[model samples]
Target: MKIGLYFGSFNPIHIGHLVIANHIAEYSDLDEIWFVVTPHNPFKKKSSLLDNYHRLEMVYRATKDYKKLKPSDIEFSLPQPNYTINTLVYLQEKHPGHAFSLIMGEDNLKSFHKWKNYEIILENHHIYVYPRVTKETTETQFDGHEKIHHIKAPIMEISSTFIRKAIKEGKNVKPLFPENVWEYLDEMNFYK
Candidate 1:
């Protein structure tokens, strides 16, 4: 099986996340798209993130109806500051016969070189790059890389950070993400 690993913090899985995954699953050659919810990102500040379980729960609730999309807690059991290379190695060892690819935005591609063992990841796995609000591309870095596929998936400017800020300001976020997730956030009073 060719699985596209959409790794993220998923502070709160929103519509943008869902749309991108759906686009990849439908348009790309990937059989499945897994939302690998990272417990903590090495490049990001941990203080602003919600609990790992809470974020995982939100991902689950949002992707419940999508058969091809799944919420993964693989990073939770791993060491803190989950790195892509380590997770990929662990996953390959655990799940034999399954080929793993990476799903990321153009923004991440801009800083791909900064990631640990990025060259190893590029050589071993396919990377599906989708457009984001800001069109930052690392074309020079991966100009002739056949493993890197540029997808014309629709880009959504909506972000989890914006959603959290809006929710904190008592603005309506129901339209931004799945209704179930919005309800869960409302009930839990998250980001308030």
Candidate 2:
């Protein structure tokens, strides 16, 4: 089976995440989109992140209804500062039968060079890029990679940071997440 590995912190999964996953699954050759919850993303700040297990659970709850969209804990057992290349290598070794491809925004590709073994990842795996409007494309580097698909996914304009900020301010986030998922988040006081 072909899988689109979407790596993110998922401090709390929102509807935007679901939409992107759905879009990738529908448009790409990928049969599944795995939300590989990063315990520690090398590019992100650690202070704002919630517990990995809690974050993972929230992802589990948010993606429960989507068979193609799953919450993965692949980084949980890996070393600190979870690197994408390392994770991909490990996943490939563990799941020999499944083909894994990278799914991310054009913005992320810009910073790809700084990642460990970024070139190797680019050479080996297919990348599915969905346009993220706010970020600049010129500054983001793709290096004329082959088999890179550009998809027009729904622009939800939402981020986990934005949702966390709303929670910290005690603001309503009813529209941010799916109905049931939002209720569960509120009940658990997740971001608080």
Candidate 3:
């Protein structure tokens, strides 16, 4: 099986995430898209993030109805401040029968060179990149890389950060999230 790993903190899994993952799953050659909820991103501040399990639960609720999308807690057990290269290696060892690829936004591709062992990641797996509204251009090295595929998926400008901030301000951001995810967030009083 060809699986695309769409990694994110999913501080709250919103509609933008679902749209992108669903688009990739249907439009790309990937058989499934897994939302790998990260426990801690080295680039992001841990203080702003919700508990790992709470975030994971939101992802689970959001993706449960999608046939081609699933939630993964693979990084939850891994060491903190983990790198993508390490996760790829561990996943390959655990699921040898499955071939893994990456699903990323154009913004992330712009900074791809800075990731740990990025060359090795490119050598072993393919990348499906979705459009993102960013001011910076992508790295020249990745412009026409064979392993990198530019998927014509929707440009999702809605961000989890924006959603969290709105919720805290007592604004109605209900349309940003899937029904179940919104319900869960409301029930738990998260981001308030």
Candidate 4:
């Protein structure tokens, strides 16, 4: 099976996320899209994130109804401040029968060179990149790279940060999330 790893903090899994993941799963060659909920992203501040379990649960609720989309807490058991390279290696060892690839935005491709062992990652795995509405330009080095594939997926402007701020301000952002995810966040009073 070809699995596309859609890694994210998923502060709260929102609709934009599901749209992109579903688009890729249905249109692309990948058989499954795993929302690998990161416990801590090296590029993000941990203090602003919700508890790992809470975040994971939200992802679970959001993706549970979709056959092609599934939630993953693989990074939770791994060491803190983990890098994508390490996680790729660990996943390969655990699921040798499955071939894994990365699902990222064009914006993240701008900083692709800075990731730990990025060259090695490219050598071993294919990357499926979706469009993102960002002003920053992508790195020229990745231009026409064989390991990288540009997927013409929808550009999702919705962000977890925006959703969090809206909730904290007592604004209704229920439409931004999956129905079950919205219910869970509302019930738990998260981000308020």
Number of the top lDDT candidate = 4
Positional deviation of residue 86's Cα in model 1 after best superposition, in angstroms: 0.4
For residues 114-179, write the lDDT of model 2, one tens digit per residue.
879877897888888887867444455565557677778987789888888889899998898878
TM-score of each: 0.96, 0.93, 0.97, 0.97
CA RMSD of each candidate after superposition = 1.2, 1.6, 0.9, 0.9
Candidate 2 C-alpha error for residue 154, in Å: 1.3
lDDT of each: 0.90, 0.85, 0.93, 0.94
Encode model 3's per-residue lDDT on 44-103: one tens digit a residue. 999999999999999889888999999999998999899999999999999999999999
Residue 141, model 1, lDDT: 79
For model 4, how does the per-residue alpha-carbon lDDT over 66-98 read when each residue is reduced to its tens digit? 999999999999998999999999999999999
Q: At residue 110, what lDDT does model 4 achieve?
A: 81
The candidate with the higher TM-score, 1 or 2, is 1
Q: How big is the positional error of residue 65 in model 3, measured in Å on the Cα after superposition?
A: 0.7
Sum up the clashes in candidate 4.
0
Model 1, span 1-192: residue lDDT tens = 999999998888899999999999999999999999988888889999999889999999999999899999998999886799999999999998999999999888888989999999998999999987764434657866899999999988988889889888988778887888888888888999
